[model samples]
Target: MLQIDLWKRVLIWALVLCGLALAMPNLFYSRVETHNDAVKAIAASGGVASPDQTAEAAEWPSFLPSGLVNLGLDLRGGAHLLAEVQVSDVYADRMDGLWPEVRDTLRAERATIGTIRRVDSAPDELRVQVGEPAQIAQAVALVRDLARPIVSLTGVGASDIDVSAEGADVVVRLSEAEKQATDTRTMQQSLEIIRRRVDEVGTREPTIQRQGEDRVLIQVPGIGSADELKELIGTTARLTFQPVVGRTTDGSADPGARNLLLPSLDNPGEYYIIEDRTVVSGEELTDAQPAFDQNGRPAVNFRFNPAGARKFGTYTAENIGSPFAIVLDSEVISAPVIQSHIAGGSGIITGNFDVEESTQLAVLLRAGALPAKMTFLEERTIGPELGADSIAAGKIACIVAFSAVLIFMALSYGFFGMVANLALIINVGLIFGLLSLIGATLTLPGIAGIVLTIGMAVDANVLVYERIREELKTSKGPARAIELGYERALSAILDANVTTFIIATILFIMGSGPVRGFAVTLALGILTSVFTSIYLTRLFIVMWFERRRPKTIEV
Candidate 1:
């Protein structure tokens, strides 16, 4: 009948084979497997993202019989979580967190402050004390709020603002109700501080929200691999650099308070106290990375922006030979005394940290920063037994669906039915081979997509065969009939697949998650079926015709 040249036959067969190879992974491979727990633990323990991704295969063999489609999260009984960021408290806490330094540092300069202390402080004020009766007038004049109503006004025109001295037997007490109110306000500030810290660690699609005044609920799915989530949500401690107080202009220590030396963690090192204040903070970090020093000891290298770098250099310069604390969330991770002024925008954080924590820190730093902290509300791991059940159910569905298609094709078109069966067989083979070659995850809906492909692919052969019968019945010669059959059937064949293709395109564009998997399989099936049915099957027919010459055509 239709004469397919040897090259056309070979080329068509090659394409069919290629498609099979690409689909192999979908048909045979297990989609759901195992997650790395070691990395997850690290993540929880203040580790970072970018864990070493070397995962070992589970010893338990796959329960999935070969050649099945896999379902996605919905049918697979996986957990999902929703969370939101806490912003209100985060901003308020950040401002207040910076307020203390703003207050006392100005006082050491003898700048007059008012409303500086809280009434047992419901909200701590940077109030100014009336200086030794005489300097008070001059101090108030220079530091006066230029705008009216900015500083609280009392005593007609504030001839003098009054306050008890910081160190005298002076005492200001709050009533029971006032203390409760102050504590509530501070808790609000603390809650906001928590949020800013969480936002610093950019866990993917993480949801952080204020549950009560002080707590935030966080949900991170697909992020439960290691303690990374734990670490990410909790590292909200802030870092600050303050000038040393009670130090003389010549750098000699004053009598007390400012020169206090605190012991370093697990070391003989000590850090000299600066003014009991913090000026610059670690809120503007841009990037960080893990590297090794000359001795090959693991370390974390960091860089800050122009603003951060300039401030950092200034802090280090002033604190040379003095220890500065690297505080995480609240606990000090490292408090190394500064050896020298660290300028030029970058520096290293070093300690007894192993390679893992150092790298995790770098990754956390590079994920920019989290805006707020979170508390893990819930977590669960899918059992391998459940994965096995899914695999088994998926197989049964595929087998039942597949056999039904096979039986229908055989009965519907008789001799041509057999040819359709051959094409169908090749179609599925190509699907598996192609999936394996490409290594696409085979979800369960993806299986349904493959099964649906059967109806579409089988329909194409039916169209061609039915058209061939029409042409043969028209009394044309066998060669002309066969050629015209393929030619005339091409328009209808293409039209049917083109319509299905449009549907597949819509599915691909609109679907999310597993629905997308369906669309992908459907789209791929449409293309493969068109090529194999029209091209490969025709080639087979051509080769058969060449070998089996007959005198007359059978009606």
Candidate 2:
């Protein structure tokens, strides 16, 4: 009788929680039912296609993504990649591959550059030492065109490796500021490239970022082909256009070409001459989409920016029927002749291509060309062999853990033990409901969190059972003892659940990925256990006592 009032209160609490569970699908979520109906209708044979006209489809707009907890990468197999960036290529491009050319031109002038070699590491910077034996002043004066870092200046006979070139060579030797900048730029460029490649191949929601300076971090949510991805992403498809060498000044085209030349549109073959400029650049193109031309041949449709359009219009206007090479990575794709003025800034490129070849070309062109070419630094892959084994091991561990807890509760408290186990099952249900409601991701460690919960959930039942036995020792009636049991155990149960909850909350805040998963399951279990133990188990106890009203109680 002393604890009957408390039992009533906890029974009411359970009822209230049941009501909250009913409202959860609407409170935290809305319109899920409508979306499901619409998707079902769409799957049917005579479904309405219009989202507006279809009653079911009209409700599709309010639907949220399934906010269910997803098993994480460790439980589910996926690929992870770490890559390094090489930025020395940027400086090398800036030099325009003229190290040997510049050296030869200087030598022809009879300038005695003492020593000439490209920096072994930087490779972009050429170190030149002048003076027959070592005349630094003479060397500097002779090579005024070359930028200076006259490392060992010579007045008359100063002979000590006078490395006078762009200080970029010395920058490599210093190895702090220069290396950092190179690493930063390389990572930035590589991230951009990787993101594009991921998009091209239809990999969804990829995360690409600079990890430190030289390394790139890439996370792809649902991609499978690690090897294919590595090959695609690692290719630094750098494209370049070198002005084709030919025809001279004085209104003269190459022999058998004067008829092909016409007046330029912007240049009029005059001031600001189109002839001075390279005909086309990849930078001008906005997008390249695969398509078939009027003749049913595979082609890539291209759109150019206003400036590129003007450059292109003038080139086509001047060289009415002359062919221009479309070079990709120095290999010519097509050297199509100018057919029309192409004034609208959009046109198509036709070649001997099939649909697949044409589509890939368009994808690459849309991704944009890399600034500098790259070589593959490294590659690694994880096979599914190990992940499958881990899944099996985790399943066995969960079954053993659940069995242990179930037996312990049944042996420890007779009929009350059975009720506690029933409450535990409902407790697990609430955890899943909460997870589905909140979109938390599940993981391997999360399975541990749930398994640990089985043993812990029995603690409240043990507290109540022990309290009943103590009251019974005083020769109290079974009903009176049961009521007193709940009353005495309430404070300790609250305090224990509250403390565990705080720890789980803290874990959720501080951890990432699998750790966060563990926190989620642990925290949710604390809440559900509190509900089921106090309310569901209490309801069973109250009914059991009211019906049996036994003269003697068995512990």
Candidate 3:
């Protein structure tokens, strides 16, 4: 009964060997990490590695597994930021876009709704006053027809916009369901753009995720500070081309109803009145790079997609000799006259830009624009010195806990206890091996979970050994007593570990950040401990029994 099947024996040994092999890289973490990064960089560069990079990549053997457990912020230091997206900004932009369509629809029925005039209203509302009060109902109905069914899962059968009439004025706003859908899209886009921006900088293991309907939580390990992280992602980088109506020195100049007056970036106090409708938005841009102008001044070169190129070429041809303003986040970066038909859909933006500004602009343009503005609600920078201290403290705690558990087990059960201690050592190794194989993050709380696991690794052996002692008082032989002990202990061992694993799973699902990290290590440790204690320790004892067939044994 104590004999393991041949297949089972092979499986157990193979699992252990594979786990150790996968986790071996962590023993030389720095070297392995460098090799991995170098390999990635060379691959990205079309497999052409520099001499230094090739030498660094050769430090680790090609056949060995290179995966290492990622270190968490508390163990590696980084920047953390909680930002709330202004979803209302998108609502206002949607309302602005709806105005042209509303005007066209109303103009076709001018005899019925009278002369409709756009009126100033709330940012989220599109308001229009009708000259004929009697036709207000018809006007509302016509605007309501503009509403399309929302295609989102949660917004099924709901209209995208709600149309209501306030006296002679028809007001339009996004429906509640549409607003919810918009918020979800905004958060998703923000998360993706943030990830792209952070990844472009090559920061290792940056966490960019949405916290709620309108908030994002970003953590970047090995980054300098929260401010630096914010600077990298904060700029909206909204570039637009609008026809310049007029130029003035007065900031208070009213540039008519459909024009906006923005101050020039290069010239202080100088302002330009530009058309509100963008000729081509940066969303159509496909590429942006920093390059020197013909005069050797820093500038940004941009290329547009096909549709954008066609529109830009047509606009440039029609508006030749007129100045067009390049606006970035409400500031007029430059105003240049259309000299030619610019058919290729490529152009240069020249400003009083330094080399760094041009480079940053290019990076922002390449990463695309954020869907909405974000207000940082919380920010913190964790120092590497604190992380180092945490690592040292965690190591000391693990060593002390491990030593105490080892001594206690050896004293309690003698030679059998020593076999369990050996299994315990391998148990810890298996924990690290699984963690490395899975690429789980190691945090301070995770370290505590592993230490706790070390203390509990011999639990199954304790149960079986105590049962053996109980059986020895009976008339059973040593081999029969041992087999019966293991058989009787199996059910209790399964029940305890299963229940504990369920709790760990719940923690991982419900908790955030460090708690999840702790749950991961705890769950993995429980699995590894059960395997080593029941199977590996039993195999050791069986081998000892075969080697020395004694009639009686000491408990």
Candidate 4:
């Protein structure tokens, strides 16, 4: 009997209806996208919306499914940047942090190693000269105690820094294995910080990923330009509070070896000499928000954690009437005198900032600083006009291919061909439905995959139809012929589609960006095609045969 069980029939139709419902929003893509954006904006504004936003949000019914396929960078047009992280900067920072520990450790062994002074070398190397040349070996041994085990898979049992004595100086630098591990960690941290900064702007589906040892690839769709993306992420935003030594009007003035000379934010040509040691850094910040100061000026309010609060309070208590500088990215944003002990662990940063600047600063501070500076190696801004053209072309290609396939199938296989046509249409719908469900971005290559799928979708139906034609010649009844046709062709269909699915899976695993996009659509198309070809079309034919009670039917 050419029959499907009652429950299976319900399941098939249910899935078809659900898929179509999920895909319906893509037909009104722009309107639904606008509605979604408006809804998000309203929620972000604490359930308040402007008249325009409210109207836009109301354009689409809330009861219906609203998820749409996200367009990729190539499809939506946006900023593209390939940046190389200045990973060596982190080495310098690490050495700077290690200096105090080395100084204190050597001072503890001062009786044997004598006094020590830091000598200039490469930015990455920490060279210290011992007053007693004969005890240089002792100084090296003491500094070596400061080395910690590298917590990395390839660096097991290896210390982070290699300490050796050269002449009268104790030379210390990161080990080669430790450098590799640090590079990996720096790239990971840079990628994460960039992602956080981009996500804070509320963009849809930005791709920020590590490309190589010291590089990151960032593609942000719907952004204005590449420069805008750069400006958003490039600032580092390393905030610190340090005690001020003095103020100067000269840029070339030296502030000693352990201090820094930074320019003021508001006053032109005015600089301040600040201590290099920070009282509390941005890493201790628990929260930051854009708010107005007491004078109604734009400012950023920040709160610190308990440990940071204790340190800050103690410093303020001891430094009454002394000025402290708020430094951001090595520039003095503010230098204010401490009037009394500030025990609240909260403070405000007031600079020459507008509302937008303050908001951006708050966002950057909240996102945390990038581990290292990144230099853009490649940058390109895609225009919306190009994206629109590509989308239009893709739509035309899909429609033409679809119409040609439908016409050819209808003429060759007759009624059965039309059934295959219906299945193919539903197959495409299910693909989009799955894509939307997964929040997958659709690129130009993904569209090409869909067009290819339109042709491949009917392969199983064709095999089954040809098999039925052969069975009919062997004098079998229409029902038996149809049953045997699907049963016999099942192995071949599975073999072909399964092989293709494996290839798609491999491509998805090994590829990135647009290649993965193509693989995703291809894989989904295969699954949906198999379901429709083997089950849904067969169900329709079985229902038709049962209704007519046909003894024989033409292929």
Regions more than 4 Å wrong, model 4: 244-261, 266-274, 291-301, 316-324, 334-352
Model 2: residue 265 alpha-carbon error in angstroms: 31
- Candidate 2 stretches greater than 4 Å from native: 1-82, 91-121, 124-178, 188-196, 199-213, 216-225, 239-328, 334-381, 413-443, 453-555
Per-residue lDDT over 1-555 for candidate 4, one digit per residue giving the tens place of the 0 to 100 score: 788999999999999999989999999999999999999978865697999999999989999999999998888899999999999999999998899899999988888888889989999999999989998878888899899999999999999999999999999999999999999999999998999899998888898888868889999999999999999989899999999999999899988989899999979899999987989999999889888899999999999999999999999999999999999998898898999999999998998999789989999999999998889999999998889898999899999999999999999999999999989989999999988888899999999999888888888899999999999999999999999999999999999999999999999999988999999999999999999999999999999999999978898
Question: Which candidate has the top score in TM-score?
Answer: 4
Give one digit per residue, the lDDT tens place, for model 2 in 13-119: 67546534633453333355455545654553245356533665455353434333444556545556777656676666534444555566446644554454444
Q: After superposition, how far is residue 41 of candidate 4 from its true place, in Å?
A: 1.8
TM-score of each: 0.61, 0.55, 0.83, 0.92
| lDDT of candidate 3 at residue 359, scale 0 to 100 | 74
lDDT of each: 0.57, 0.62, 0.90, 0.92
**Candidate 1: regions farther than 4 A off:** 4-14, 21-79, 90-286, 292-297, 305-307, 375-379, 429-441, 550-555
lDDT of 1: 0.57
Candidate 2 vs 4: which has more lDDT? 4
Candidate 3 residue-wise lDDT, 1-555, digit = tens: 557778887888898888888878989989998999899878855688999999999999988899988888999899999999999999999998999999999999998889999999999999999999889999999999999999899999999999989999999999999999998888888988888889877787777777867889998888999999999999898989999999999999889999999999999999999988899999999998888899999999999999999999999999899999999989999999999999999999999989789877888888899998999999999999988998899999999988988899889999999998999888888888999888788999999999978876778889889988988889789988888888888898889889989999999999978899899999999999899978988888887988898798866
Sort all candidates by lDDT, best to worst: 4, 3, 2, 1
Clashes of 3: 0
Q: Lowest summed-lDDT stretch of 10 residues in model 1? A: 146-155
| True-structure Cα RMSD, model 4 | 2.6
